[model samples]
Target: MATNGVHIIVSGRVQGVGFRWMTKMVAAKLHITGTVANQMDGSVEIYAVGASDQLAQFEAAVKASPTPSGRVSDYQATPLDPVPTFKNFDVIG
Candidate 1:
């Protein structure tokens, strides 16, 4: 897909779960640079930048396993204006 800055919003049963932490771990393993956060609206928000192949890996990582108590109803991703300066992924609030 050759994505630039990839933004994703995963909905359903995500808040209060370990989604963000798990995302950080996978992102680190894949060398994805971005941020993952728990949205107030009970979803998980992810903003990551990397190669398209890596992004595919990232997407799979996100969907493969959520928290033990988490179940995703739907998730959407969009290509963002490239931000190539990012370095290392993190969990934000």
Candidate 2:
């Protein structure tokens, strides 16, 4: 299958709660390559590359809050044009 990419923004009680760590783990399991980072505005930003189905699954998984204490109030995913190259899923600062 061809690969696709998405840019996601997760809001609400996400930062400082292991959200990025859990996102990386989930992305790895789905064989997705991307980056998860905390935005200065209290949201979590994600850039993921994978199959379309996997990206949908990833969005669901992240919105459900895999981290013990994280709460995701909003999840928005936008299709990326010219998917960025990523070697692996990473938690970035």
Candidate 3:
């Protein structure tokens, strides 16, 4: 299967709001393999890899912020060459 990747940077009340955990859950549900972390600049960064359709769903879910407490003001997803490294989604500090 052809795989794709995306580097996402989410801003606005993302950190300390369980955003990373929420992302992990969503990614796992979407079968996306990657990592989500809190950036030094008070934003959340995610690297996700999966099929194009799955990645699209993951992006939408991340933007929606499944957790009510988390608020995603803005986000940017950049396409990347898929690297077969991640075996599962994780929340990283």
Which is the leading candidate under lDDT? 2
Clashes counted in candidate 3 amount to 0
Best candidate per TM-score, number?
A: 2
Model 3 off-target regions past 4 Å? 82-84
Candidate 2 TM-score to native: 0.94
lDDT of 1: 0.80
| lDDT for each residue of candidate 1 in 1-93, tens digit (9 for 90 to 100) | 454678899997777778888788888887789898888888888999987788789888787654677778888988887555577798997
Q: Tell me the spans in candidate 1 whose CA falls farther than 4 Å from its real position.
A: 1-3
Pairs in steric clash, model 2: none
Q: Rank the candidates by lDDT, best first.
A: 2, 3, 1
**TM-score: model 3 vs. ground truth:** 0.91
TM-score of each: 0.86, 0.94, 0.91
Error of 3 at 30 (Å): 1.0
Model 1 Cα shift for residue 22 (angstroms): 0.4
Tell me how many residue pairs clash in candidate 1: 0
lDDT of all the models against the reference? 0.80, 0.91, 0.86
Residue 26 miss distance in model 2 (angstroms): 0.2
Per-residue lDDT over 1-93 for candidate 3, one digit per residue giving the tens place of the 0 to 100 score: 779989999898788777888888888788999899898999889999998899889998888885779888998988886465698898888
Judged by lDDT against the true structure, how good is candidate 3?
0.86
lDDT of 2 at 42: 97
